[model samples]
Target: MYKIYKFDEIKNELVKLHEIDPNFIDDKNGDYFCIKDEDEIIGYALVKKIENNYLLERMFVKEGLRYKSNGTKILKFVVNHGRGKRINKIICNNKDIENFLKKYGFKECNGHLELDNIQCVNQRVTEGKKVVMSSIIQNIFLAILKITGGIFGSSRALISDGVNSLSDVGSSIAIYLGIYFSNQPADEEHPYGHEKIESIIGNMMGLFLLITAFELVKGSVMLLISGKFEATPSYITILWAAISMVVKFFMYRYKMRVGIETDNSALIADAKDSKSDVYSSGGVIIGILLSIWISPVFDIIVSIIVGILIFKEGVSIILETSNIILDKQDDEFIEKIENYIEKNTPVKNVHDVYMRKSGDKIFLSLHIRVPKDMTVYNAHNLADGIRESLILDFENIKDVMIHVDYLID
Candidate 1:
């Protein structure tokens, strides 16, 4: 006979369970139960029945006491609970948990079960947020420095560069909001999930960049026409511009790494924006140097060129995001995906391999050919397997729809 600890009392104990299972992130709202031996809690399990499926979110036993019967008891208890709840499938992505479930008759499927139809936690989304937040914080400090240095040093070009940095802060804020709403688990209203908003975020960023470009262009033209395109050259202005170039180059590389890792288009756009910042800061530096040697008119001229370049980039980003929203097909990626599916899954034929991007998330639709004699359940499981395989292969893919057609004799 043993004692069972309630969720509230032993929930904190599960924090250390991450070491046992890295996928076992502790969520307070999840149903938690702990197996206790007298006053010491030896094991814990967490589950959530989302939509119509059950998610075995996390379970673990203490390292020292794992060889005992505590783990077995917890597994039996949760399995029984799942059965009682009419949950046909309980899914886990962790290899250890998956192997353990197999011993109890849970077979590996093509795709992991979506708990109650809710999407699983996306690690890339988490990483994306971290990258965006870091960009915002760093941009704030840099913008302040550039704006302060520009005003005091009377360098219009540097002030405009400072404004560009400020715009990046706004873009990052928009990206954070996009990532936030996009990750809200798929619901009845939107079975495909809420990530499509990222394309809109991309479009907004594009529009913002274009507007900033317009303002800079207009200001530079006015200064040039008025014959007042002169900046009182200050070492402080050049110093800040040099600092900005270094900072933005680092940010560009960091965000680019995050963008590639997450396969997130919005973050990639942010990375490109950071790259543009590097160019803008570089332009500021060159303008300051020229003003020192040649004429201050070069500063305004360089600002105008920078504005035109940013406008060109803005158009490019808008077109890119627009293509995503329009469901533009990429034949190259489609072929790659089909080949990947063939290599990884049991399915022999894949057709109509259509791919679309919604923000950082990818939506894939494909028809799969299966044996005519296969049972519906078997086919469904195969489809699930294929889906999981695809997700594992492509981290950006959010939703996959596999249409199973009977293999004609």
Candidate 2:
């Protein structure tokens, strides 16, 4: 919006004025003046020469200085200078600013309304489509994974797949539902979007993995204690174990490929679990074979080994997922954001940066320091620009909050 004017065409002095006060240069006849703090321009004003009166064309203080009466001081300078020039009447164009100028005896001109109806409508339509498409794709993928896993394996195996299938189901449902409600714009119930729901689902998936591990361990231990190993294992048991191993090996590869393509942690974990199942099933097959050559006790020992492996995988999944739900910060992400801000903004420094993660989404908060003499509005606009730029460049960022601070004593 600010780029509508050609800054290069104006006089260097007026260019300086426009930088200080954006509304200062227009077709109206005016003399642009800048208010300096030491060597730096902190505010700007434009006084237009009308037929018999001087109009207060425009005035603006740099963003950081607005709350310090800098605007009022600039207005006073325009009034006093106008009186000395024998200009009795002063006019102000903006109605909102007219009230502030009235204290200096300036009268308002007719109000002007700026409308951007087309832009507003287009933005809403685009946002709506994004929400709809994301939801549909996520739900479809989840259903496919669940159906495929269930049909190919037993119910217990499907359930024990843990981080792979279960995690996918949880994350997909959460993203679909979260986006549906979060895209509803701000309401009384939730001023912020429902993005955090992704984290909740991620945490739930982690817990599910833990449960799955426990059940697998319990089943393995029960087999060991039941003295089932004392009897000679049947040929059917070895045949089934061989079949399960082959199926699981292929499933492991397929799940791993999908997980890598999607960059889904849950899916990756599930893929690992499938790979582990291949080994465990193979172990069972070997244990039965060895019983014929060695002793039945080897079968019981192998079962215990499989149980321990399941327990370890469960603990790993819980730790990773819990970190995400707890909003643990990633140093790499913070460094990326900091580098972006320093490169794009006129900010002198950035500090107190905080990052929060909810599943794959990242939230950022930081303080940016600019020159001390700028007005509050200018500082705010700069912060807004930084926020907008980050969202455009980083796909995973869900929200950002910036605090503007002056770089002076």
Candidate 3:
């Protein structure tokens, strides 16, 4: 039996443990453990309790102790603990971990319905719904706000509204184009598919957001320098801003909900961008009020602050889009891939595991070390099985390539 420690007790040790193996903590939930061999800690495991179910957060053996049955012992300990706690089900993230859990009687549950097991397709559908809904609502609300602003707003208010209107229109067009092109079938000219187009669109959206922020900042500075800031906003401008804030808040919530459900980067980015609009608009409203009560200079200051905030968000979106366009795999995702291979391959060792991402799709490449005396047919079959296992287990994985080599040991 392994020792089970509370999150507090294990958190400190985890810092040290991570230097040896980084994937030893559960990000979602649960207690951490250190498996000892004859009084020496050899590995670590995490058991995340989730609504009467237990998730094996992560299990890792020290590199030197990998082949010494530490992994098996950790699995046994986790399964026994789950049973003792009267938890009927245990979930694991990796396919290899799932197989190991199954050997101890865990069954594959519905991956789509369960949040912990949501597939890529399921996530995409959820995001698509959210984007569609949010886009529609935001467009309508902005149109109304523009009409109201034009009727009763000051020069500054009207100009800001114009910028916002342009941003909304550009974002809508980019989103539509992205969705259309992302779904196109692959052809000879584009073997990897059109998924990267989403990233391109996202980057373009970010660029536009940056430009909008810059313009807002520039306008505010010019207003302040020219002493054009108003001491009071018209009642209609205030009312319109209030209504816009409320509507944008709900829109943000809806889009954020869908983004989390679907893991759609584009939709998630849009949600973030939309949420920023709420904040920006809210600040503008506040600035108008403050300037009315105090001096007109406060309005320019607040607008500058809002512009900086929006620019920060734009930078974030740009960075994320850049990663996708450059085909850079997130380190955590790469680690997950390596862990999956090490645990599931049935080989003596593995190395050079590589992963790349194109939009929501994942591509993996790795080398496995097999026994020298193994038959070529058996090795080929093993490679094929490994690829198929990954495909069946992880829905986001679009492709995998496994290279086999003979191990000297």
Candidate 3, overall lDDT?
A: 0.68
Please write out the lDDT profile of model 3 over residues 240-294, one tens digit for every residue. Answer: 7767778768777877787666555676787787788788677777776776777
**Clashes in each model (backbone N, CA, C under 3 Å)?**
7, 11, 0
Q: Of the candidates shown, which would achieve the greatest lDDT relative to the real structure?
A: 1
User: After best superposition, candidate 3 residue 15: deviation in angstroms?
Assistant: 48
lDDT order, best first, reads 1, 3, 2
**lDDT of residue 41 for candidate 2:** 60
Q: Write the per-residue lDDT of candidate 2 for residues 63-123, one digit (tens) a residue.
A: 8988887777665555544544666555566665655666644433355322111112323
Q: Each candidate: what lDDT?
A: 0.77, 0.56, 0.68
Instruction: Give TM per candidate.
Output: 0.68, 0.54, 0.66
**Candidate 2, lDDT over the whole model:** 0.56
Candidate 2 to truth, TM: 0.54
**On lDDT, who's better, 1 or 3?**
1
